[model samples]
Target: MTRPTRVDDLPIRDELRGQHAYGAPQLDVPVRLNTNENPHPLPEALVARIAERVTEAARGLNRYPDRDAVELRTRLAEYLSRGGVPIAPAQVWAANGSNEVIQQLLQAFGGPGRLALGFDPSYSMHALISRGTGTAWLSGPRRADFTVDVEAARAALAEHRPHVVFLCSPNNPTGTAIEPETVLAVYEAAQAARPSLVVVDEAYVEFSHGRSLLELLDGRPNLVITRTMSKAFGAAGLRLGYLAADPAVVEALLLVRLPYHLSSVTQATALAALEHTDTLLGYVEQLKAERDRVAAALAALGLEVVPSDANFIQFGRFADADAAWRTLLDQGVLVRDNGLPGWLRVSIGTEAENDAFLAAVKSVDVVTKKEQQ
Candidate 1:
């Protein structure tokens, strides 16, 4: 018998045999606007709080972390309730990251022989996680402008009747927010087709021009709203994400989550971050302003910039986006080529970082050279 030298030779899962693990390239560049990370480092006061909290938690490290993360959940609920929508602790759940929160949702409500649906060019993770959990994935339609066409979406929902539906408000790569009317419409269509679980991935909502859909969870048991601290909290390295849904929905996820899934250190750090939510949110306002500035500058340069509510701008109608991406990378600025036909996304950074990106764009003369080329 021949030795198994490649993945193809091994008895791998049929679906995963040729699949690539999903992620943007984490390049070591000077200006990394590629990954949509909060450019601000965690404030010093919060760092001190984290140290104090972790020291206390370390004393009890011999025991398993709060298997349920009850206190952490309670604080999270309080943090979310700042919107005037009361979120009870029981309605909140936590995991290592929003990616894990999504995975657990898929495990509980989606799996072998089931289907999950999302609009294309949205978060890629929705499809990848679905496949990883043995759930069939379906692509819904987005209009030329990247907004979901309500009628087409409803038709798809009725036809496919997916076990899970993902709606990414302030959608990744595009930075467009889904209107409440569209979400309501989609939820109704899903319910009519089947008792489906509709997940609204609000991972970037903290920097949005509009409010969160968390308030809508009151009457919609099938609805779920997932959030992350990575973006707004300036704690991306902390790896904490959570969701708000009906208690019953959270109860379903409980069955699929591993024991002690959240470490004591994570809980401590997240709790510390929550204590400084006010200060952290001040940074969000700054990013939101910078996002507007970047979008304006890109449009002024004659790039086709999609209107953004999130903390990034997707721009371009480049004849070869990869060329544009490579050009920027050469200038020590990195942005994402999200595989969209002629578009790329750049996360908003600090004032100086954003300035560097703009300078690079102007220096490259991307728009002017296109006509000459």
Candidate 2:
């Protein structure tokens, strides 16, 4: 029999030769919270609306989708303007997911001979996407609490003079939101160093306790804030993500975007979701409350809980995070061990699911109890 060729056998780029793909485990567990997904299903009303929209779109599937996704961009612009930022359709761009948004941004602003920087332990995809685009990746510094250290970040920006700087608000894994002051500092430093593109990944902003950083876009042409429907809209399956930036940035992205990148069905479904924005955001409020409840409950158990502005909570001082993750999994509850030593992240699920997860955590002895201060 002929041998099956291994991935290593293919002549792939040297940068990708040994790297693992970015993903959390997809195990079929009773209470799955590993992927930071919004646990709620779309409302029946919205489901019906999506069906109507998709059906309307189906009639024209023989033709290519809107190359610029005009109407979708207009609706997204209006939706963002509710944050008081007054965004225009010309300033918005949509893609498959925030991953694609990041990929496109890197393709345009970063590549061979250019470097991209993100704080250590923020989103892994920023670095991964940079590598895929052949852009050198640099890891900046963060405080022990997982907040970006302004001075350290500025120093790194000055030292590396990276062409692209990524800032993730309500960052993943740790669930820490970058302060507005820190974002401003980094943006200024990035520009001072090399007039770099500062992309803020706001994929979880809807669940934050603070206001959206959308207002910061004013006068900062180098700034970009990326968002996703996967979390707050409960539409991960829809694969819709977008960014709000200067009109010039949008124009630049046009140069790198695939022709008719968004499918008609995607645009139709996203428009349907936008029509029910208020309803979807109501779920965000519930998850915010549940997130706080989960954080407090974890603290009450003497486990260290990182303050989270996003829909997920990062808890534990587990001596062995992998073992703790497995223990939780053994109990029919799954959480993310984000390779951050002593920590694991759990998405805010429905109240009942959260209760089940807390119960499973209570059963485990792997959690290192936080010492009373």
Candidate 3:
């Protein structure tokens, strides 16, 4: 056997080693409850509208898109406020997607000497991004239930004085929403320190009962709320993301944004997607329904599941989550295995998909019992 050049060997940071992310199986299996994606596809009417708009915009492909992405930002400002978080068009800006939005936040706030503080066992991608940029990374202990630790977070803000502090509500993997008051406490202290950005990564806001901080926009120049069309809008392919903040912060993002960041096709497709906002919302309700129903069924199977406000559920304490993950895959079901040892995350799928996952778990239970003999 000969050794091939590793991706890490190509003049990259030591962090970029052979070890990679643990992702859900992306197969077209009988059921897929992984990656926290909406099980439903965009409605037919909306899909048709997107097609028409994209074709119409194709004629103008030679022309560059608006670097400022004027109309889309206006639409988002209005959409984000539909629930709460009232924001004006002038205060909003968007990028390729929220992942990019997070990176942009880091670029604008983080640098050589500056540190970035966020909760541990939260979004693993945050650690990856912060580490890649050579910024000092600091972590706060999350509560046992995975909610953001208010006192701990505040202390880190005071101690490290990190340039950026990330708060992911209805956070990833754990699927728990940090209380708004808990997040605000960090904001109050971070603002007093000058030039710190508190980003509320509300990537899964549609399913949450608690409203976004969009309405709390005014007076706090340091606050930024991040959102995405990928999750609720069924526009994952569109690579669209938006950030709400003061005009000054929005302007800074524009400066660093790749020129004409929003493609004409992307804008046209996104605008079309917005036209059927109700269709997407209906899907949200369906997924919420599935989340509750499936969680109950899993509990009945003797699995302990974390209380979730988002689309996914985290469950386990089995001796091995990886083996359980393999069992699901064997039965043609797939889910996300998380950072927490002995825990796996399952996204809410359709009725049929839910049934398939249940069946798989049933088989696993029977097998474990037999092994006891």
User: How many residue pairs collide in each prediction?
Assistant: 0, 0, 4
Q: Kindly list the per-residue Cα lDDT of model 2 for residues 275-311, writing each as its tens digit.
A: 9999999999999999999999998887889999999
Model 2 ranges off by over 4 Å? 1-3, 366-373
TM values, all candidates: 0.97, 0.97, 0.93
Q: Lowest summed lDDT over 10 consecutive residues: which window, candidate 3? A: 15-24
lDDT of 1 by residue, 2-25 (tens): 775988778987887888888888
lDDT of each: 0.93, 0.92, 0.80
- What TM value does model 1 have? 0.97
Model 1 residue 261 CA deviation (Å) reads 0.4
Model 3 local distance difference test score: 0.80
Better of 1 and 2 by lDDT: 1
Give the Cα error of residue 139 in candidate 3, in Å: 1.9
Q: Give all candidate RMSDs, comma-separated.
A: 1.4, 1.9, 2.2
How much is 169 displaced in model 3, in angstroms?
Answer: 0.7
lDDT of 2 at 69: 97
- When 2 and 3 are scored with TM-score, the better candidate is 2
Predictions ranked by TM-score, top down?
A: 1, 2, 3
